[model samples]
Each structure stands twice: as structure tokens, then as C-alpha cells.
Target: MQKQREVGNRVFVTGIGLISALGNNVAENHSSLAAGKDGITKAVHFESLYTETLPFGEVKLSNDELKALLHLENEFGYTRTCLLAVKAFEEAVNDSGLSAEELSSFDTALISASTVGGMCLTDQLYDDANMKFEGSEYLEAYGCAAHTMRLIEKYKINGFTDTINTACSSSANAIMMGARLIKAGRAKRVIVGGVDALAKYTVNGFNALKILSEFPCKPFDENRDGLNLGEAGAYLVLESEEVSVGKRKYAEIAGFGNSNDAHHPSAMSDDAVGAIISMKTAIESAGIDATKIDYINTHGTGTPNNDRVELFGISQIFEKVPPFSSTKSYTGHTLGASGAVEAIFSILSIQYSEIYPSLHIETNMEGFDAAPITEFQSDVSVNYVLSNSFGFGGNCTSLVIGRVN
Candidate 1:
């Protein structure tokens, strides 16, 4: 019989890096959260009719500049997707304090999450009439997996790597996958995260859905409209027990769950069936009761249906609803990157005991009493944090991050 996997392998997070509209790296992101700053601004990165028509949390990096910083191969056409990811990856690797030579000591791997890889490159190619592709090589790389391969080669770290594209839940699912890999003894150390840069496609797609909010998103608010699209990349390196010795471990990925409502292509079930199942599964896997969840990082996208359904799920399950926050208003809806972006917030919450508030909350929606802590808060002891990420296709994930030692 296959050995019943107890939480035998202790997976601890050692390194973290973030690049969001709110800030760059850990310090900036943390400070923005504290100041209750909303990073949503009018579109300036790309020329779009959606400019002020739709606001976004756009990063301050340009594609050419990013390629130079990452020292990307000239032969390979770099996109905003790869640029954002490498920025976060480099920061996380530095935070881990492990050089490329040192990484050889452990079985390290990368699992990246993204929905559109080189689509930005694909979209912008038309602008350059001089550019020509005689071979179909660029076509395959246009898909989301292309960035994962880029990350593996760029970093010179080797083990296993794959890409996940479960919409917004992608990176949270990536975190779960890293822990599973460690649990299965597949890799000792894993760099798992997600990255996505703002593009007209996503903006137009969500706009077509009529859910793109022009103003800053106000999740769980009575006046909340919908999410503001954003660009970002956030990554964390997870290490198994032996690999984490002497490292400054931030928090432990205690347990995680990924479930699907499969109810609709874009909309979630009004009853939050998927979220309920996912939360229960995650808490159980963490070997904790619902009451132990000290804080929750909700998948609050500021969407009309999501806010109502998610709150309903939390209220129905946890007895004393934990103080929850959605950093989306600060970073905007980061598409696939939202999962990992918020995971960084989740870990920071555990480390500093700071409850990052959900910005732009004007009023609480009916039936939801656990509204966001509109004002910033600090210095709270939290043992376990339930970070929830839900995405299109009803893909829902709940990750339990616990403080180490």
C-alpha cells in the first residue's frame, strides 16, 4: 500500500519577491498596504481606448528594459510576461540567499503559473513590420508554458518545472503543487509562483464581460462594481525540512486545496459551492479546525457575484469569522498572478503579524458582516492564515500558511 502521506515533509517558505502596481519587492508592497495606498491608475503602459475607460494596476517596467535587466537571449523574443516573471524570480532567489552554485546542493524546481505567456509579444508583433518569423518556433512559445522554460534556463536551476493556467487560481495552485512535490519526494526545493503583465486582451476580455471597473475595485462593498485589471509577478521559494536549514524561513505552506465549481465559464455559483468544498478540504488537510484560521486572504476580486458567494462560504463555515482582507484593491486583479501576489501578503501577514487591509471599501454589502479592515492594521499574532484564490472556470484554491518556529 502507498504510505499514507502525513504532513511528513515540512515545507517552509524561505524567499519571497513581489512586483505589483502597489510596489516592488517586499518592502514596497508592505509599505503600500500599510499606507492604504491604491495602486490602480489610468492605463499608461500600453495605448488603449480602455485608457481611462478602464483603470489598471500597471507595473513600472518596460519590456525592453526588463530584457536587458534579465540579460535575456536576443534570439528569443521577450514579452512582458517573461519580463515580469524574471524580475520576481531574481528577487526571490536573492532573498533565498542561495547562489546558483549553492542551488545545486538541493533538488530545486520551478512551477510557474500564467494564463498568457508571450501573448503580449504576440499582440505587439504587428507594430514592427520589420520583424519576420520564418519558422513556427514562436507559435509554441506564445502559449503559457513558454515562460516556464525561460525561467528554468535563465536561472540555471534544475529539477522539474511546469506551468499551470487555472485562470486566477494559477499561482495558489502552483504553491499547492510545490508542497505536493516536496511531499511526494519529487523535489527538495521549489520556486513556485505566478506572473502576468497587463495586456489589452485581458482588459478587453474582462471588459467584454462587463466586469472591469474603471475606479479602484471595492471588494465586498455595497458600492463595489468589479475588478480592475492589473500587472504583476510574485514568487516564493519553498524548501523541504532538510533544505531549509539556516535559512530565514518566512512561513510554512501547511496545506492547500484546489477545487472547481465547473458551474460556468466565467461566473461562480451563487451558493459558493466550490469555495465551501475547497476551504473545508484545506482546513482538514492542515490538520486544523475552522476556528484555527486566524486571518483569511480572500479571493475578493470586487466582482458582484464573487463577493457575495465568498462571504457566504466563510460565514457558513468558520464559527468566529477571522479578520479577512483582500489586497486586490491595492494591486488590482492580477489575473493568474493574483494567487501568488496575495500569497506574499499572506506570508507577510504571518511574519510581521500585520493584517493588510482591503482598500477602497466604502460600505459593506448586505449579509456580509466581516467587511474589510478599511484602515491599515498591524501587530497581530496569527498562527494559521487561509489564503483563498478563485479564478475563471470556477477554479478555487485555499492555502494554509503557518508561521515556522
Candidate 2:
């Protein structure tokens, strides 16, 4: 057993919100995950040459529908990415019972993450850049920080606000940053997560990489071929122990670790150096033995390289690995949104004492000595969970979430 060490002020997850192919809100997503439902389907809202061919974990709502739902129908310059973030952000603040005054207080902060951002308007951006359009409403919304800026303005946030873009690890880093702020006494509460919407840019890019699966992804399977791109937005409200005293906490943000291997642009090292370091550091910071982890929400992108290297990293950490599964099989790979998506899934495991299976897996990868949980399990002991998010350029992050006792 590893020696326990105190980190800092404890951070608790007071609320969560999400919108993905699985569902529109936290409750719906929880129901889908509990039932082992698969959300990947052929793209309906996104227009692309591969729309009918490659499957994606796309939210069911269209741009107009989202606008109507958000009551921003007449508004301009709100991209799909911004709309999604607003939806999830609203839910998170409501769930946390944050008031307008509290939200605008100097003790509150907003840290968001996104990769697609307004780039989801790839065609509009290109047309506007080429001066094909006289005036474009989306010209100011083309950057990755566009969504963050929108949130800051919408909520009248006055405290520290920042945006992170570490590829797939973006949201995980956002969560880590939020926790750090609370621990450092910079803020009493932090709203953190990420959002990304499907665009022709990412679709064409992944297709070019030859990593788009025609069918639903089968993560960690020996026969796993590639990943199905996904789009989603999710957020979690983290509050300091003092502020969260009267609130309902789903879990504790026990610890988090991040590292960059810089091994490859989009591939982790074969030795899993980044993964090993992040996971180990998270466990150590949490002051828990690696064996204390009851479940792991792996960053299983259904790619051959990711699955193999992640398993290698796990093997190097624990003498006996914990039971783990990939919820990406449910939501696909939501890119920047994946880290927060899986973090919420990890909290669900702790809250419900249940394990959601990695769906569509056929054969376990040979020589791994570890296979993902293949069926829905209930009444399981889920005290601690490790959620992983590894992204392009070797960015890897892990968060240790523990049950609120």
C-alpha cells in the first residue's frame, strides 16, 4: 500500500450536466449508461460525405432545435459549439443551485475547454475569411475560446476565467485547473468542463487518418479497428468543502495528474510513459494505494494504438488491475469533451454503486491479462474510480474521484 499524503483543500463535485448522443441531460445520460445503451449512430444533423457511412455519437438535436431549446432562436453569432456549452452550463449551475449573485461573485470562476469551438462552422469560416460574405455573424466566434467567452458574458462571471485546449485532455485539464484554483484559495467555486461539436474539419481529418469505424466502436477489443468520432458537452461544478457543506456532493475530486509525452502528434508512446506518469501521480496525490481504485473509466478510443498502450500503462502501475470499462463505447470519442464526459461517468459509478459495461466488445486483447467489464453490474463496491483522458500530442490526464463518505 502506498503511504497516504495530504494534498490540499478538498474539492467536491456538487453538480454535473451533460449533453451527448446518449441523452440531453445528466439524468438521461445516467439512464443510458446504466442500461448499457449505445448512442453511436449515423450522423443525422451533421452534413458530410461520410454522414451515411461512418457512425458517430452525435446529439439528436439540430442547430435550430438547440437554439429553440436554449431560447436563443433570434440571437446571432451563437455557434453549435456555443449552444451546446450553454445548454450544459445552464444545467450545471442549476443543479449546483448557484445564484446570479454567486455566479458573478469574485469567489466564483469559470474554466471551460473546447477543441471544435466555432471551427465547427468550417464552411462559414472559410467563406468569411475569403471575403465571400459582406458580413459574417460568426467571424468573432471562430476561435476555441469563443464558447468560454460566451459563458463568461452570459453569466456575468467576474472572477478568473480561462480556456484550455490540450486536445482530448482538454476538459480533464480544465477540471484539474478548477480544483487547483479552489485549493489555492483563488476561488470558492469553479464551474469546469468542455464542449465540442461535430464539424467537417474533424470528420475529414479523422477519416484521413483512417481511424473512423463504420460501425459502433468496440473499445479494448482485440479486433477493434478504429474510433467513431463523437460530439458532446459536459460540465461539473466543483466547490470547496466549506462552501459545499449544505449541498449534495456526488463525489470528491480527490486528486488529478497531467503529463505530456510529446511522443507523437496523435499517438501515445508504445511504452505509455505519459499514461503511467499521470495515473501514478493521481493515485499518489490522492494518497491511496493503486489497488484502492475500484473502477477505471478508461480513455479507450477504440483505436488499436490507444487500447494497447493504455493497457501497458495500467500493467506497469498495479500488481492486480482494477475492473475497468470504456464509456466511450457509449458516447464514442467526444474529443475535447471526452475527459469531462468520462469523469462524470466515473462519479456515476461511485454514486450508484454500479458499473457500466464497455459495449460491443468481442474479444479481449491478447496478452493484456485484463478485460473490460462486459455487462451492467449493480450493487458493486465502487468507492474510488480513476478516469483517464489522453489526447493528441501525448497529452494525458487522470483524475481520482472518490465516494463522498
Candidate 3:
């Protein structure tokens, strides 16, 4: 007995689950964002080269609580990253109107984005064998691919389970892939988003890059430093039009664009050529006015060079930029998880009929005189929001979330 049928391939997000540094689930996260609060704080897990020298958005869930969510038997070998994913995935599936069995009625896919997957577990494997060593019993399944597979089996989804590792733009790109699947009539329902747990590899990598901040991150401030790392996993349930008949829909994803600078492996081009092209393509695909956009969720990592180039790129696009904010101050840099986490935040703004501020931008960066919304505003109708994500290797992506309904 099939519960739903696939007709038109239009995709709508009926369910969302997120656990970040700010809060564990939707209610908690919404409260934190509403109060203009920040989640960046001291590192509570793992030793790091920049432990005391840097801050991060670490979730407060212990391994025991994480294990309970998955109802795993006996002791577990999963890493902190996998645990976070399990928690968020459970919430997403539970919130969606479709039950696991009902979702199995049609082609369902679980496509996720990740970077430094299962990092905490990998770190433990390399630690001193004599110091509480468990011999890495299940070390093989902790990476990105295996972690995703674990979720697919747990949920009994009979569709594709894959990982996208496009650096920071991974999950945002996941949505683009999901849209393609729907347009091609590949699946009636899909789960798309990203997950990442804080790890020594990421902290040390950022420290080596000299972009890890000790205090809170300031996106476009003149005294802005670097970003604070964080841990999170968020998911979106995308149901095709035919399957979404009775479900509440979120904002529509109108257009998306991705491009690589090809200039520097670790740095974005000074001219922001790639970013500009990506924004242009996304807006063009949406077939909307540049000035019609009401908000922007910037990939503002609070780094020096990144701010300059991003602001320059925005100014180049329109004569006047729209009200913008960076939710990173509230969630830290969730890395691969950032794109999807921020995407949900953008959609929330539309659903709640409000706008969240970019927390730490106090002053404009020197060369870029662009403005940032530092205070929360409401009743401002948001027709479209531009969410940007740019990462190492010059990878950049832009998505235009619109209210064409």
C-alpha cells in the first residue's frame, strides 16, 4: 500500500532538525537567536594546540546521551561527530509527518555534506595506546562515508546515501543536488544537509592558518579577528510536490550557483571574481531584481581578507546592498555544517516573519565600508535571502531562497 505518489518534482522542506553550539533543537536555537545571544565559548572537549588560545561553539551532550538517542546496544565506538548526526537525524525524522515506513513507500535519498568527519574518533586512535586506549575497535566506520551509511541503515532508507566534501560549501551544495534529484524525478523525498563535530584536526588547521580566534568572532568589524570553531548537525526533509500534499512547507529554494576561484588553495581571490559570478548566477536563475532581495546570510567567517573581498563583491553586485547578518556569531563556524545550518536560519526568518542580527560586527572593515545588521528587526517582509559560503581552495557558492508563493 503506497502512502504517497510522485508527480511533479518540486521540493519542499517539511521538517528541520538542528543541534549547534547555541542550542540542541529548534526551540532552544530560536530562543538564543531571538535574545541576540552568542554560543562561542571555551573548548570543553579534546586537547588542542589552540585550546586556551581559541574559542568554539561546542554542544553540551555527553557520549551517554548521544548513545541513548540511537538506542545502540552495548558500548559504542562512534565519534562525537557521528553522535551529533544521530541526534539531529532522529529529530528530523520524528518531526517530519512521514514515518520511516511511509517514507519507504517511494524513492528516498539521504545526501549529506561533511568535512573532517568523525574527527574526534580519528584523533583518539592516534593518541597514546597506553592512555585509555580501546584499540580503535570500530575505527573504520567513523569517516564521512561510514558515518552517513550508519544513519541510512539506522533509518532503513532504501535510497542513495552519499557524502559531499566541497569544503565549507559542502551542505549548501547538498541542497543544490537535492533540487537536481527532484527536477529529474529521481526521488519523491530526500534528506539533505550536513554534520560536523569539533576536532583537533580542524582547530589545529585553523590555528596553523592563524585564523582561529581566542575571543568571540566579529564578522565585518574593523578589529575583527578570525572565526571560532563549532560542532553541529542539521537536516532538512525535502518532499516532492506530489508527496508534500498535506505537509507544511518552508521557504522555496529558487536558485543556486557554485564556482571556484582557481587562484589560491587556501585563500579567496582578492578580486572576489568567483563570489561575484556565483551571486550573479543564482539571482539570474531566480529571475528577480537585485534590489528585491531583503536580506543576506553572509559566509562572513570574521576573517580579515574574507571580509574585504566579500564586501567588495557585494558592492560590485548592486548599487545598494540589502539588510544582512552573519549567524556565525551565534553558532561559530560549523564548517561543512555551517551552510545548511545557516540555510535553516534563513528559512526560519521567513517562517517567523523576523530577522536575526549579525552579532559581532561593531565597525566596518577598513577597505570595505559595507554595513551589517547588528540588531534584530521584525515585521520586515523578506522576499529573498542570499546565503553565501566560501571555503578553502577558493570554493564559493551562493543560494537565493525566495518567497515566490
At residue 314, what lDDT does model 3 achieve? 91
Model 2 spans > 4 angstroms off: none
Error of 2 at 28 (Å): 0.6
lDDT of 1 by residue, 59-145 (tens): 866666677777764746556787788889889989998778755444888889998666765355443433554544455456787
Where is model 3 more than 4 Å wrong at Cα? 1-8, 73-75, 127-134
- Against the hidden true structure, what lDDT does model 3 obtain? 0.80
TM-score of each: 0.93, 0.99, 0.93
Q: Relative to the unseen true structure, what is the C-alpha lDDT of residue 378 in candidate 2, on a scale of 0 to 100? A: 96
Instruction: Please report, as a residue range, the 10-residue window in candidate 3 with the lowest summed lDDT.
Output: 1-10
Task: Give the Cα error of residue 176 in candidate 3, in Å.
Answer: 1.0
Clashes of each: 0, 0, 0
Pairs with steric clashes in candidate 1: none
TM-score of 1: 0.93
lDDT scores for all predictions? 0.84, 0.93, 0.80
How would you encode candidate 3's per-residue C-alpha lDDT over 10-50 as one tens digit per residue? Answer: 56777888999888897788889989988888777656766
Best model number under lDDT: 2
